[model samples]
Target: MSLTRRSLVEYAAAHFGWRRAYGDTTEIDSLLNEQALTAYTEAADHAALATAKNTDALAVQPGVLDVRGRVLADVLYLEGVLTGARNRGLDPQLIERLDAAVDHGHELTVLLADTVRTTAAVHAAS
Candidate 1:
């Protein structure tokens, strides 16, 4: 069976009990491995804020650097997992399921980012 993007996203959302409709054209971007979604979400607010505040001449900051590094590691790990899964001749459906889970996690990150930004705006207004 061939793996399509649709099948993967559905599996991810279902695993998380997330009911929101995910569009096919929606792009998933993140700096994490498949296993790091939970970790990133748990730390997103503090990590994101620190990243935003650490602008200086010196490139290496603290929180932001750590977050970015972890994100890159996650992406690499995910890529390896995907490649390995495909190489194993795993059922297309099963592979799609894992892919969907990862995609869902990435989408959640985006949603979280949106929420954080909106909350910050509200705080600023008040």
Candidate 2:
């Protein structure tokens, strides 16, 4: 399902324990940005998967900036945000999927971290 700001923020506040609210929303805004970026990147990855293409579009083109690292950073940040998002809410129907989403986020973070670290190591060793 598509994520809306209300859904995202409410979900975070309800499930993620975003209890702290000051006059300035810098922290929440950062979280929201991370969530939106993650959602957008995840959707693009899904689309690429459906089309039988490389999920990381950056991996497809040479000299295209290869934003895999940046994307992976966002994914890693997103996992934390999502973990918080699922911290509170409960639903027999929705809980399973939400759990899976959080799990997926975690797995993505690990995978990306490993890949980036390995790549960096290789580059460093060279």
Candidate 3:
């Protein structure tokens, strides 16, 4: 499924204990949307470059790229949230929650990178 602001908000709520009442999510949502758009743009560029480098290469599945982009966008969102909370001097509990969320985001990023690399290798060989 495509990434949505609601999904990201739900993720923040569930994982970081973020509450809409605590802070207006407008800024966060805007940043996330921007990052998501950038991810798609970069993904398209990467796909184009990959295809150009290897005329025989099978087209990379757009879904795979989309998932990769979403994972990256999540990581960036978590990082931004953590930074913003730190800058605002939010409660320690919320900061800790966001810290953990960032750690989880890092883990997700690593896994996604590995998966993409492996998938790309497989695609290149086929």
Candidate 4:
């Protein structure tokens, strides 16, 4: 299945302590927007670099990368938060969930990156 912004948000909310309340919405929205913007910018930068190299590299889809980027960002943010929580002696169950989330996020990121790399390689070969 294709990665989606909503899914990424849901995953973070489920694993991390992200809330969908009034105050938290702003932060969540900002993170999503930032990742989306970064994804597009990176895609453009990649395209420019490919052009400079004179190789017909396939264009990376910003939407796909945006979700992956958000997932990675969320995982990193959660890891720090988890560390703080651990230091504060928070609930063991919550810590376990956060740890699982981080591991899952890393797996997803690697899989996505590999898929993108394989696709680009195929396109370049063609």
TM-score of each: 0.38, 0.34, 0.49, 0.52
Which pairs, if any, clash in model 3? none
Put down candidate 4 lDDT per residue, 1-126, tens digits, no spaces. Answer: 234775687689978877654357767687689789989988988776756764443555444467688888988998898899899999999899988988988999888777667657778789
What is residue 51's positional error in candidate 4, in angstroms? Answer: 26
The best candidate by lDDT is 4
Candidate 2: lDDT of 47?
69
Per-residue lDDT over 1-126 for candidate 1, one digit per residue giving the tens place of the 0 to 100 score: 123564576678889987444344323332224338767777778677657764542333343345545655675667677778989998999689778766765665565555545555655676
TM-score of 4: 0.52
lDDT of 1 at 89: 92
Candidate 4 local Cα displacement, residue 18, angstroms: 10
Ranked by TM-score from best down, the candidates are 4, 3, 1, 2
Residue 77 displacement (Å), model 4: 0.9
Model 3 CA deviation exceeding 4 Å by range: 1-61
Worst-scoring 10-residue span by lDDT in model 3:
54-63
Best by TM-score: 4
lDDT computed for candidate 3: 0.75
Clashing pairs in 2: 16-84
Q: Supply candidate 2's per-residue lDDT for 22.
A: 45
Q: Candidate 1, overall lDDT?
A: 0.59
Clashes of each: 5, 1, 0, 0
